[model samples]
Target: MSFFVRLSLVLALLLAGGCASLSQQQRDQAQGIAVAARSTEVNCDRADRCALDSPLRALGGQAMAESTAQAPRHYATILDEGELSLVARLNLIRSATRSVDLQTYIFDTDDSARMVIDELLAAAARGVKVRVLIDQLSAISDVHMLSALSGAHANFELRVYNPTFGKAKLNYLDYAGSVLCCFRRFNQRMHNKLLVIDDVLGVVGGRNYQDDYYDWDREYNFRDRDVIVAGPEVREMAANFQAFWVARRSVPAERLNDVGKALLRGGVPALPEASFLHPERIEWVDEEAADPDFINQAFVATALPVQSVSYVADLPRKHRRERAEEPLAGQHLTEPRLDALIASAQSEVLLQTPYLVLSKPAQKLFKNLRKRDQPPRVVVSTNSLAATDNPIVYALSYKYKRRNLRELGFNIYEYKPFPLDAPIDYRQLLPPALDGLPPVPERNRMIGGSAAGSNVRGSGSGRKPSVNGSEVERDVLRTETRPSFLGTRAVNRPLPVTRKGARMGLHAKSMVVDRRIAVIGTHNFDPRSENYNTEGAVIIDDPRFAEALAQSILRDVHPDNSWVVAPRQKPPVLSGLNYSIGKASEALPVLDFWPWRYATDYEFKPGPDCPQPLRRQDPGFHACYSAVGDFPEVDVGPKWLLVRMLTAFGAGLVPIL
Candidate 1:
């Protein structure tokens, strides 16, 4: 045989072998495990009407009035760190004798995530019906982990809320399809985080199933807060879960066969077998556990409830005029609620937040109080430069924040790291140096004493100069007038400006109105949260509850735990040069505003070394910049980017990804 022919045959053989191996791998990954289908259905329309007229009506009304009273009411404690919240959540799941419904934004394959999975599997093993509904985007992200949970138990049933097959994987052909699907899926995201264990106990809050949220790592521990309800409210949360569960977008886990087998082989960690068959060892507490005397004082001194203590959110309208101006506007308790609650306020409005970037409307709301005939004191606590995990967000925030709020005549405070009694060190809280060094402050000293006999100006230049003339004159004057001017002309110095208020507490997001009613929820007052992400929360009506939560925040949480932003007496002054530079940066256009411009112009551009002619437009610049700029660079690597592109494109067609 000729040498050329032999080489061709060898190449063919190698290609064929590679193709067989790839096919088998794909087959192995695609194998699906069957999941037994079971669900608990509650008709909310019927219940809503029945609830208004039933004996439950009187119970809910009375409960609303003295909601904070120490009755034998059920409540769940939200622990902020470690496996504490997970442990609490799992314990409730295990104790369930009837039905368990769990819904979350993200469920990972991490230790804590797997632990919950194992427990759910066990619950299903014992004939306790368990339904798990997770967002498709999140589930597909952890398909392997979720599939393992599905394969291990028949009683366990899982569904993906909004799934797009081609969009989910995005191999080469799907990329084009995904682009067409992007628009419909981009704005629609499932931001609800809930866990309803049985129709009796429920928890709704901000924390997600990630390590950073649980405080497993000191560097990323989120200072967050959540609420647990034990009464009829649990039923409401359960219904919310069902509404999303049965929605057209949701699909059973059995549908994703390929993803399931991979997860099963990976094997979800097994739950430790333990019995909490009795309630005694559960460490569970009810409303009665809270001191009654303190509870009574809280109720009697409680301020009126915010306007419409119970309110519902209106969905975004499809038509322009009918659309709610802001989809998230009514999610929290409104300004009328704040007014009624804040009416009796005497001293202060203290706010603690990890992310303290407030919108223009929010800024106006806080500023209006300072405009009052006799404005009450107001203080804010937020993260300093060194303490924040999201520096980009902080940079964009502090850029216009202080000056705007100060201009509105409100005292703006920034959190600084210092001992509780120590003064703030303002320079330390400035954006951290890239090389990790403390910023040096420039000194400008003015000398005017009789011994010196003249005014002298010390150079305002930050760096020290080599000149010796000023030092010689200063030495002679220091020796002669040191004793004469002592205690004679005391310089009236202001308090040492400290950066003590810059480290805001974590995870707890709340608004206290007149120390009366407090609105606590998973929503952070951030642009990403307000405009981009979906969120939910409850507006508690009880004054005692609000006061207790508020005091807990101000006293225990805010003092040593949080940094305080110092309130400025006047608006911050910026040079015209700086103002112009800022305006120019804001005016510059970015690609997120126009998504498709980059594909042909930048993405398909050939390399310079290649002999192929360069395209007139380098679409790669748009593609490259858009990916780097718009999406969070962390955790989402090249492969994830490819997936995101494909998903986004697919979402454009399906309207659900």
Candidate 2:
């Protein structure tokens, strides 16, 4: 074993040895959750009435009413606009007078998180019952600090799923013990992102609650997508929120330390005596909302509905230890439901996900599609090695992803990092609200502007660029065509000074099938999502929404935004007979040669001949280029070797990626 690997294992064992049981106070506080949540019951189970009309009824109710009447389900695709997504969530909280339920995997303690949290607090202040359920690990130290505030309000409740054992200041110790002790169950987690307000509207997609999710982050911004739904389907969506909210594994905020009887009664800072424990609420202000806020755009534009809308989610017990031996049947439903959705596709299947480790069903589907008389066209867009946040997963998933899938006749496109100066057309993803808005110099909209050009109308989506699908884009990924590799040069333009450098990575996961159905969710189309962690999505049987989603996926994979995953000879075998023997001695993960590297004799600016870093710097996308132009280059590293070693150690568990 490598020295570092042995050292890490030893450290984990040492930390696990220090494991301690919960204190009596902690146990008592955990019991307090039942007493606390009773103040306003979460009654989504009742078929008769899931939720009563809130102040939103006074705001967007009429539009929502008109929208449902015209369609089976109302939906809108949130393109690359992070600001607008933040605005949408803010508006949902702003307009909601009744209740808000937010469930997310990662809620970072960044500006975007602050905005969302403060808004939820304000909503609670206004008597809108607020419920937030975040994964225990992803809830960073700052978010963990809110336990006292949860003790402050009955209307506002915070729950952590799969609470970790270690309270070590650094937090790393907790992950080590948790994963080591109950490795399988602990490994399974909730990966869904949802926000349901008053049980009438919900936002579902791949984006999480962090700066990267909102595009405000300087270092990295996801070219992600989300959908806002306003109609009958939300009732089921709200039920999904309730499923996770009240699960057995969830712990109330009061179950934590720094929480006591005093903070419980104080509510938000808006209430007298609440200032000391909860200071964020002091600066909170409730503004009168614009009538046709950005959310209005969804109901207004996606009025034409489809045959049906189904909000499907895995059961809460997906990760339950007590039920680990139970049949997978009732424990998980998302994957099966996802399969049913895929089976319904007829002519074409357009998939966009950040991770793509083909599950058995996925492979079978591709095989069948390839054999069909006149098979439906299938195109997939996912993160290339350089752009992925999880290179470990990329290494595990990339082996033969193209060769195998392409041999089955599926075309694949890998997302390229956006140039610091790329212009994303906002109207294509959002409503017309962004159409005419003048460039805000403070926000730097012109250079990477989604809100660009004179004709600000949301129309003309067809006019936008589709660089990844272009022939030149294909040539870059096609390994057969030899090109001259050349020296590195500084990109023609300078990177901006946006407080933090910009990063453009793909996190959007959605699919449009035959222009007849749309499936949007957090499912990554990987084994991890399939057999392990839970996931959720909203499947809409509507042509208009599907087409719009289809167009969006096409635009994202365009050469300007992505690189084609054309065919290539197998990647070279691992070097050194010992290393090869060692790898083959155990289970190897992805064995496919990575086709993303520049071809031999590659001629291009900032070309392949230049030395590339094992890790790309923030906004470091300029290192690689193609015939068309330069974009961010994929970042790979020694970590790939480390991940392989770790995966081999885990053996049976490693495929969870």
Best by TM-score: 2
lDDT of 1 by residue, 219-303 (tens): 2234455555555465667776776777666666544533544434443433234333223312322121123332222221221
**What is the TM-score of candidate 2?**
0.70
Candidate 1, residue 457: Cα displacement in angstroms equals: 56
**Candidate 2 C-alpha lDDT tens digits along 1-657:** 999999888876756553654577655754474345334543244432323233333333543565545564353444345555665677677667577899988876555576677777666656678899887545544433554445445678778776655221224444455555655655567788899877777888887887657654434457777777666677788888888888887766555433333234442222222222123211221221233532344233333344567888887877754544666647778888777666666788888887666766677867877787887778888876556665555544444343344456656666654433223333222223423444434321222423211111233222332222111101111110011112111111112222222435677778888888888888887778887667998887777667767776776665555665432232476334433443344334434232242211111234365444211111433334333311234222454444444334433433666
Question: Largest lDDT belongs to which candidate?
Answer: 2
Backbone clash count, each prediction separately? 55, 24
* Candidate 1: residue 528 Cα off by (Å): 3.7
Alpha-carbon lDDT, every model: 0.42, 0.55
lDDT of 2: 0.55
